[model samples]
Target: MDLVRHLECFVAVAEESHFGRAAARLGMAQPPLSQRIQRLERELGVRLFERTSRQVTITEAGTLLLAEAREVLARSESFLAAARRIRDGETGLLRAALTPDVSGETVAALLADFRRRHPGLELELRELSTAEQLAAFAAHELDVGLIHHPCDVTGLELGPVLHRDLGVLLPRGAVAAGLDEVPLAALTGYDLVLFPRDSAPAVYDDLLTACARGGYTPAAVRHGRGTSFVRGLVLSSGAVALGPRDTHLLAGPGDTDPDLVWRPLAGAAPAWRHSAAWPKGRGDAAVGAFTDAATHALRTTAGARFEPSARPLHLRPASEYWL
Candidate 1:
């Protein structure tokens, strides 16, 4: 007989003081209940109850075991409750990674909304490049990732988050200042500060291809590991950088240098795309919750007719290509 099962029978019988009543309370036949109690007594070498024709009274051993049995059942109930909460995404840690190019306002708003929805959950945020985020997801070190488009995505599932037109960041009083929009060809004479190609190869390549189409090549290229660092370099060195038109959302009043200005790129600038990624087979509730929160936040912030793409970047039409 299972020890806990027997103990349950014993406790029932001891409390009810009648075989028929105990069996009814346990939703079992009296014979089975009696047998369970007999087995339990035999295993312990002690009679848990003293029985007469009309009455059943628990002995000292029964009283002692009753307390412990109740405690065990209580703890078991607590363990099950905790497990259910974690499975429902009500309690636990959610580890999320993002590329450095992701806007700070975007991430902050996402986390704030997720926290409101799941107060018991803790969030772990890491700022990594798109490639690094993918590596972390592959190793199961990250629960979810916000990454640039045209990623490897071999064993991952992606959901499009946001898309914006490309723009150029230039120092004040630069050669392109008078124009409302800067043509790609007009950037030929300026030193370009760009994120390293290894950090986001497809985005970098698309930028180069677009420039080539415009019949211009950068006079010099300087690499930076992150958006903020590259922007800083552009401010200090009078270099130009290309970024999403909404890049200003990531900046505070004092975040951008007073002399720097962001202007839309004239004619056929490729759109910048970002997506949420996770392991293909991952079924964790926290991952799903975070993804939902991120999608909603992006839509709310974009405030336009934003639509998530149903296909991967590579499969999308040429017009929708992300740079």
Candidate 2:
């Protein structure tokens, strides 16, 4: 028996108080409507109505069940509505990550834009490296991440790739810092302050390779991730750090240091590439929204730009690409 349909018939007859009127309201023949009500009464083992030639009157039992039937219908409608919202990615928990090197301004931009776009979604953002984000994706722990390029992406989907040209941060007292632009080969005696190799090995190795090609190799590679840490190493140890043209990246807030300068690399300086990534077959609307926000933040806040011919530059060993 179609229980809901039977209950609907019962309710209609109870409210209409006449078989002819109930059938007309339900857009069904009077005989079929009466049969449905009869079946409902049999199923429940209770008579729901008293019918005479003059009028129809609902039973006390029928009156008691009317409110329950209406409540069930209302609840069913609410369930379907919630399901639609989930399917459309309007409400849920979304786990996202950004690399440590990302500027503070870019992080704020990404958060503000993503929230504006998906106010119903709860964003759980974290600071993670490309390596950590990839591991999280493999373990099903992360939904989306802004990751540095040249890392393995064997089972991931990527968003638009953006690039930021890098410059050097050196002590202002250094001879090379006096020039309009520092050549890669100019700082022969300075050690390099770089992020730890384990954080992003592929990018780490690629950066060293680019340095070698440009005719400069650091006396020693000092690993650090925090801005203050890198700045301390650069200032105290005479080490130089490769960074974007943004001086605040290394100088930190309220830093009016007279001994620090950031200058563009004169030749073919390396460009850092980034893109939003998620597990394969999981590029849903929420992930797409995050990717759009990340791309916008990188472009507008971090001064990164999309390259028309963007591709992973250091995926393989350098020897593999040699002519």
Candidate 3:
């Protein structure tokens, strides 16, 4: 009869691909389902399905609308569920894109504890980069994201967890061995081994600015598309980099790179903010619960290693750009 009814009927028929099953799922008869589809098509002035005596297939328009309808329905239900939860104080799935970096152990423990405390809530975890993670949250594909700090992500609510300072990981006295501990300033004189620009473009750009602030132009020795690759490069090459001390997850204490040592940067070492973020204006209980869990996790686990991301400084709702 209206948009919501049309969506419900259309989605049911599409998924079942058989009018009988769809009608059954909707607790209606086949004839009503057929009528609803026809009414929806008349309203839209488009054929949404192609029908033969034996089977039914969705038209291109139907395909497009199917995804959207499903999303709308889910989100609508989420809203209803959120309202009911407000009355009953319950929660739903806590979809999250979590960045796995320094606080891996901490994140695990936090999630585990949350799950134990709130068994009714479901957490869907997707491992993604800083950009991908933020984009997912903005698109509403993810309810929340635990991402690397310092990027201007538009269209999300950001809060600080804590702060972790950056240091140069180098060979012992590697700073003396044609290297410098002053990360940004040292860029001009030594080979800069760092993550590729694609992984975190803003970070790479910021590093450039940091270097320029030191009146230096960094010379890149090697680039890693991923973390492990960069660590491999650092192990063998005579280069230095500036990042969070915990970022050296690829290397360990007993894993002695006789040449590698960590030194605090002279200027503002590229510090990272690890915080919980979500799409703006979403008041779903799932979203709220996830944010609460993540906040608690990051707060207790992050300790002094993470800080709140500066939202005023970066783009708002940065999800749209990435998506």
For each of the candidates, the C-alpha root-mean-square deviation to the true structure, in angstroms, is 3.8, 3.5, 13.9
**Per-residue lDDT value at 274 in model 3:** 64
Per-residue lDDT of model 3, residues 1-323, tens digit only: 57777799999888889999999999999998899999999988989899999999999989988888999889888888777864543555667777645457666766786676667766777777778776676666876776665665577776555566666665565544344446465545567676655555665566566656666564554676456666666666766666665555435552365646666677656565666777777646555556666667655654444444434446334221121
- Give the lDDT of residue 230 in candidate 3: 63
| Residue 200 displacement (Å), model 2 | 1.5
- Return the TM-score for each candidate structure: 0.84, 0.84, 0.59
Q: Candidate 3, 128: how far from true, in Å?
A: 1.2
Give per-residue lDDT, candidate 1, residue 188.
76
Lowest-lDDT window of 10 residues in candidate 2?
Answer: 314-323
TM accuracy, model 1: 0.84
Residue by residue across 1-323, what tens digits does model 2's lDDT show? 98767878888898899999999999999999999999988989988898889999988988888899888767777888878877877778899999998887888899999999999899999999988998999999999999988888898888988988989889888899789878899978899988888788878877888888888888899999988888899899979999886426544432266768888898788878889999888888889999999999889977898965846544666331121
Error in Å for residue 109 of model 1: 1.1
Q: Quick one: ranking by lDDT, best first?
A: 2, 1, 3
lDDT of each: 0.75, 0.85, 0.67
**Model 2: how far is 2 from its true place, Å?**
7.7
Q: Model 3, stretches more than 4 Å misplaced? A: 1-91, 149-152, 176-183, 186-188, 254-259, 283-285, 292-311, 315-323
Q: Residue by residue across 147-239, what tens digits does model 1's lDDT show?
A: 777767788887655676777888767888557988888877778777787787776777776777875577777898566687778877757
